[model samples]
Target: MIDGDDVGKRFAVVEHPMQPRALAAPMHRHHREDEYSFVLEGRIGAMLGDTVVIGNPGNLIFKPREQWHTFWNAGDTPARVLEIISPAGFEHYFRELGAELSNGPPDPQRLAALCARYALDMDMSSVPGLIQRFGVRFPGGPSPAPQ
Candidate 1:
């Protein structure tokens, strides 16, 4: 992860593995930040606004702030993507989530509190359908955002 503190608040980058048939995140939107995903290997499926498309390595997909979006591995093989979130700082959300998870399964209240502190809006309502329709894996539990 690229710490925002070291980047003049420009952006933060995170590299994530997208296991075969795995969804990176549930449908959600950041009202204060924009995110772009650059595929590093294999293939990925993404929903940006109303368009849903499959992206291959080297493809860069944008999910602007205030837009609901999600991405998943769209192939039989593992994939990877580099996520860049602009204006920095949201990386702290992912960091705290890891810390909170070290104890055990996530507590709904703590997860909610974390989301509130990060000003993130995440919805798991469409997760089941997404997993079914896209044949993607959902990180079992009430966790709304990606790891």
Candidate 2:
């Protein structure tokens, strides 16, 4: 179980299998923070601006401040990753948002609202394809109903 829920600047290393989903961090461009991630297994897709990059084991991605980006696991097997935020004190946003959404999957409108609040404008018309490709499931929702 990933106690990523446990808070503090120094994170205790823990890994858990997450059902696939295009998890987006509320859209905030870091001006002084640089985000880095390493793929331990499976495919990880990252969207930055209009560019989408797929990451596999041995792949490393860097998103400099002022560039908008988010990532999601995009494979049958669960993807594992370790993310680092530079200039420090940057994980708080993630911690708080995780707490809010930890209760359950937000309704579509809520999800979109949160995304809009964060500036993550996502098009769910293609979400079905992503679900098919990534094998992602919402936290408490049944397997997506056929579209």
Q: Cα-based RMSD of the predictions, in order?
A: 4.1, 5.8
Mind giving the per-residue lDDT tens digits that candidate 1 earns over 18-137?
778888777888888898889999999998867898888899998899998899898889999999989898888888988988988689899889888877887868788787777777
* Best model per TM-score: 1
TM-score quality measure for candidate 1 = 0.89
TM-score of 2: 0.59
Cα shift from native, residue 104, model 2 (Å): 3.9
Show model 2 residue runs off by greater than 4 Å.
Answer: 1-17, 26-28, 105-147
| lDDT, model 2, position 80 | 82
Report, for all candidates in order, the number of backbone clashes: 0, 2
What are the lDDT scores of the predictions, listed in order?
Answer: 0.84, 0.58
Candidate 1 has its poorest 10 consecutive residues by lDDT at 138-147
Best by lDDT: 1
- Report the lDDT tens digits of candidate 2 across residue range 1-147: 223345443333323234455343333455656777777877887777668798889898777777866667666567787776654545544554576678776567766565555443445454454445444544443364343
